[model samples]
Target: MKDTDTAEETSPEPKGVNLFGVDPLIIQDHYEIDYRHSYAQDSPFFVGLSKGDLLGSRCTGCQYMYATPRSHCMECGATTTWEKLPLIGRVHTFTVCYYGGESFLKETPFILVLVEFQNVNTLFLSRLKSIAPEEVHIGLPIRPRFTKAPTFRVTDVWFEPMGST
Candidate 1:
């Protein structure tokens, strides 16, 4: 067999949606949006946001917590136990985004981070706040910021640099 590492997979970029439903400027965008809606709504992630707590799932048999709330353990395929996790970790990786396609976050420069919960042996990718670009670094500590929405609808999950409070 040929080595895949030596080869590159190339494809055309998908265009945005077309004006008519029948016509697809970019089919991938439609699938991407559908994928997000299917997973993001009514899941444990949303429920956790509503409660002002970070929720994760753990393999009951293995004691491994899933930061993104999966149904089964990736390691053992066992049913997971739901639990709350302390909103603390260190940034294992991060990137600054200057633009958000959505209206709510448009033009807001924000930090996208992957934090490693050392105790759980898991990582969470989330948005970070209250820190300048120069201050962000690998292994920087951070904590969650629970926010409430109008009419009791929980909406946002935000985190800030540690010691910012």
Candidate 2:
């Protein structure tokens, strides 16, 4: 056989060290992916926020109202229809969040509120802004503010104490 061919066949394979040994190893990495999804029946709610409107759902059979969108009625198992919700509502309840999900982690210690509107059967959950957590109360007047350029996300709308700019 040729010298070059014999050398190639006999060369040892390369090896890597097991740097981690018996201990657990950690490797930091950044991962991201583009995800596409459809809101289907709830599309109108997000669309309304983009146009500076808040949309809710009402039961067709029982006339029960929801401050948040619902495809079906929880009260009577009936279908729901879209309804325009009032811009103003009152704080039904509230809490100061010391920990949050990844998107809100940097804004820790924020306030979340359950907003109640007149004639609406259910309360809407939203982030509260422009006020200290201690200032929030059971009946504090609140109003929703929309993002000028909406991303069709729940984050597009938030609540603030009424009369604040």
Candidate 3:
């Protein structure tokens, strides 16, 4: 009886993705939630983005380059060295996000593109800009559009067409 009472008194553990202090069990199928989270800025990724520069990491083991600029290489597991990249790339592929789902679901559709930078062995994904959905295609040249004032977040930059490519 004590166990039963204790169980009844305690709420069930929250399931799925809970945004903020929202109780999932009490929430309906569709709801809106506003929340904020902090991201670490100790890496070159955020720092380079803040400065409008494309930084990459090169692996000495396999000589593979990472555009995302990690501390270590994924292949063969070696420490990476940082270098500045050209900051321009071609669109390898992309997805049109008509619906983001759950707490997301943007009102307007947006394009998330996977770009291949010059002399880099890694592919970077970010929001694609200045291109219509109908005009978006593979192999389109893109360049970064940096904010005048950067918050050192990934949102501080986006990619735009590099002149008719």
Candidate 4:
């Protein structure tokens, strides 16, 4: 057999646009990413969201309860088991988004909160409902407001304050 170095030396030219070529790569290209995003919403967490129940994953090794459950644990790489979580939580932190991308621009001046479920190790981000953006505060008691007709999507999850004292 011919030596690899010698073989490569006699090989045909590679079939790609070289960087130093006269016709350089196109600097402006817009790709429309239009396809069904099917994987992220296929988990037990999304199923529970559709059913108006809070579901999570518990790590068997470290006992970490993820509000938005993944199939595996982030810490120990162990398989996780599905667990039910309470809908009620408190606002750990928050922001009032006045503008964002096209989809979010329609919902301007909305309160987005990072919620900490009672006794859970992690916090979850969701939109705060039934509360004005100016009224949101840290440690505000909140509960998830699920759609009545049940849309099987993550955006179906939002929170409402429980009237803090």
Best candidate (score: lDDT)? 2
Q: Which regions of candidate 4 deviate over 4 angstroms?
A: 1-34, 40-42
For model 2, residues 86-117, the per-residue Cα lDDT tens digits are 98999999999999999999988999999999
Global lDDT scores for all candidate models: 0.74, 0.92, 0.79, 0.80
lDDT of 4 by residue, 1-165 (tens): 465567657766576746456554568877888667665534667777878888878898899888776778899999888888887899999988888777678888787888899878888988887887778889888998788776676678889988632
- Writing each residue's lDDT as its tens digit, candidate 1 over 1-165 gives 356643334433345644445565444553334332344433666766777877778898788887767788899888887788877788899989888757437647878888788567578888888999889999898988877662223337767888997
Candidate 2, superposed: residue stretches over 4 Å from native: 1-21
Clashes of each: 0, 0, 0, 0
lDDT of 2: 0.92
Residue 9's lDDT in candidate 4: 72
Which wins on TM-score, candidate 1 or candidate 4? 4
Among the numbered candidates, top TM-score falls to 2
Error of 1 at 116 (Å): 1.2
Query: Sorted by lDDT, highest first, which candidate order results?
Result: 2, 4, 3, 1
